[model samples]
Target: MTRTQAPRSSPSRTSPSHLLPTEEPLALLRPDGTPVEGSPLVMPADDVLVELYRRMVVGRRFDTQATALTRQGRLAVYPSSRGQEACEIAPVLALRPDDWLFPTYRDSVALVSRGIDPAQTLTLLQGGWHLGYDPYEHRVGPQCTPLATNTLHAVGFAHAARLKGEDTAALVLLGDGATSEGDTHEALNFAGVWQAPVVFLVQNNGYAISVPLDKQTAAPTLAHKGIGYGVPSVLVDGNDAAAVYAVVRDALRTGGPTLIEALTYRIEAHTNADDATRYRTSDEVAAWLARDPVDRLSAYLTARGLLDERTKDDVAREAETFAAAVRAALNVDVEPDPADLFEHVYATMPAHLRAQAEFLREESA
Candidate 1:
C-alpha cells in the first residue's frame, strides 16, 4: 500500500506513518482534471464542489479587486493571493462556524471566503481601524502582520478550549517564511504537548518575499517541521481544491493539532509595492498560472457533468458583482479620527496617553 493509503481509523495510532507527512504532496486531482487512482482520500460531494468553486471564484475576484483598489488609492496596500485560491477557500470551508481562525495579513481571501465583509477584511490594510470586525463575533482573531505569531495564538486558544471541555478547534494560516520564526517552534511544541485541536495551514508559495525556500530552510518540506514537535504534518497540492478540502477535513476529524504545508505559488508580487519580476522569472509564473486552482477545479467539475458552461458564467457574474459591491463600499471620502487610536488602548485613558490624545486633537484643530 502507498504511504498515505491507510485510512485514519484512530487518533492514537502509535505508528510512524501517523507521525510523519507523506513524502510527496497529496493531491486528489491532477492538472488535466482527473483524480489520482488509489488516493484513499474521499472526493467531496458534487454539491460541495460546486459551492467550493463558487467561493473560490468570488474570493479570487475579491483578491484582484483589492489589488486594483490599491492602484486607485482606495487601500494603503494590498497583498494578492491570486494563485493560492485553493489554499485560501478550501480551509475556510473545512472549519465549523464555531471553530476559530487565526490568519495573517496574506489571508484576506480566506476571510472573504469565511463570509467576512470585503470592506471589513481590508480594514487593517486600509490604514484606518485596528480591526473592522470584532473577533468574538466572527470567531476569527485579528490578522497578524508579523510572521508566525498567530500560530501561537491558535495553540493557546485550542489548548484552553480543550481544558474547558469544549469541542473546538483552531485553524491558523501561515506563509512559508513564518516557518523560520521562533513562535512557530513554540506553537508546535505547545500543541503537541497538549494535543490541542489546532491545525496549521502553511501556504508554501515558493518565495518568502524574495527569499526562496532553498535560502530559508534546509528541511525537505515545511510539513516535515511538525515531526520534530511530535505533531502530524501533511503536504498537499495547494492548487487542487478537492485535495485541500479532503486533507484538511481528515486532519480536523482526528481531533488534535496538525500541520499542513500547501504547495502553491505566489503569482503576484509580495504586495502591490514590490516587483515580483526582479526575484522570479516569467516562465515560472506562467507555469503556475496554467495550474491555477480555480481553472483546474472548474475543468474537473465541468468534465464530470457536475458543472456546466452556464453555471460557470453565472458564478463569474456573481464574482464580478461581489467585487463591484466591495468597490462601491470602499469608494468613500472619510477623514481619519486622530483620537481613535487612543480610545482602544485603555479602559480609562492613562494620563500620559490622555495628554498625547489632547495634544494631537489640538494640533489637528
Candidate 2:
C-alpha cells in the first residue's frame, strides 16, 4: 500500500481518550507553496525565511555530496536525508543556543545546521575516532548509530538539568522505525513521568530500512505513541519547514515532553549499501519528489519576492562551495594510529587492556 493510505491500527493497542486532537498532519504550506487557510504559522521575518531556505539548500547539497563520497569510497557509508531537508533544518534553526540536540546517524544534516563543522560531523561515518566534535562546544550530542539509544540519553540529560534548576531543553530526533524500540518507549515514559523538558521529533520517512510503517507499528499514528506515556503529541507535514519549526517551538515552551510525528518520505535508498528499488517502486519516489521540501520552500520564497535570481545564484554558489570543502576534507587520508584505539576507552585502562595496548605498541614499534 502507498504511504498516503491509512494503515490499520492493531486492535491490541489503544490510546487514551484525553489524547490531543491532532489526527491529521499539520501543514502550513500547500503543495503549490501557499500557506494553508488559518494556519497557525505566523510567517517569520524575511531574513529568517531566507536563512531557512539557505540551510535547506546547503543540507540537500551536503547529502548529495556525502552520498557521492560514499560511492567513491571516501566515506564508509551515508544515510542520505535527501527528501527530509526541511525536517533537518527547521528544528535546529528553531532552537536556542543553549538548547541541546540529540540526533541519530541519519541526522548529520541537523548536526551541521547546529554549527558543527561538516568534516567533524561526518567523522563517525568516515570511520574516524570518537564522536568527531565536542558535544559540549556545540550543545549537540554525538550522532547516535544505535536506534533509540539517544532518546533515553536526551531524556536523562533534560531531567538532570531540570533537577539542577537549569533552563535547558533537549530535542531528540528519531526515525519512525525507532518507535518500535523498547528504548523509545522507556524514554518517553520517563520523560512524561518526570515532566522533562524534551521534544521528540520522529521523522516518519516511510520505510524503516526495508520494513514499511505497517510492519513497524499498528498504533493510530506514531504521535499517538506519546499519549500513552501522558505526553502530548502532534502530527506535522515533515516537508513543511515553517510548520515543523512552529510545532517544535511550541513543544519547547510546553515545559514537558512532546512527540511530533512528521509524515515524510525518504527519496533515496536507506544507505549506499542498500537498494531501495528492491523494496519500493520508483513511482512512489516520483510522487514524493513532486512535494520535495527544498523546492516547495524555494517556490514560496520566490513567490513572496524574497528570493530573486541573484539571491538564488548566491545560495547555489554557497552550497557548491560547502560541498567542495567537504570533498576536499574527505579526500585527505589519515592513517589510523594503532595505539590510539586504547585511548578514551576508560579513565584508566584495565590491566588486560593495558597489556594489549603495550603489545600493540611494541608490534607497531
Total residue pair clashes for candidate 2: 0
Error in Å for residue 252 of model 1: 1.4
Query: How much lDDT does each candidate structure score?
Result: 0.90, 0.90
Query: Model 1 scores what on Cα lDDT?
Result: 0.90
lDDT string for model 2 (1-365, tens) is 89999998855634566556376788888766887898755666678778989999998999999999999998999999999998899999989777899999999999988989999999999988788899999999989899999999999999999999988999999999899999999999999889999999999998889999999888888988877788888889999887888888888878789988998999999999999999999899999999998888888899999899999999999999999999999999988888898899899899999999999888978
What local lDDT does model 2 show for residue 263?
Answer: 89
lDDT tens digits by residue: candidate 1, 1-365: 68879875856746556778888789989987788888867899888899989999999899999999999998999989999999999998988877999999999999988878888999899997679888898899999999999999999999898889988899999999999899999999999988899999999999989999999999889998888888999989999999999988888777898999999999999999999899999999999988899889988898899999898899999999999999998998778776788877767988988889889989989
The number of clashing residue pairs in each candidate reads: 0, 0
- On a 0 to 1 TM-score scale, where does candidate 1 land against the true structure? 0.93
Residue 339 of model 1 has an lDDT of 75
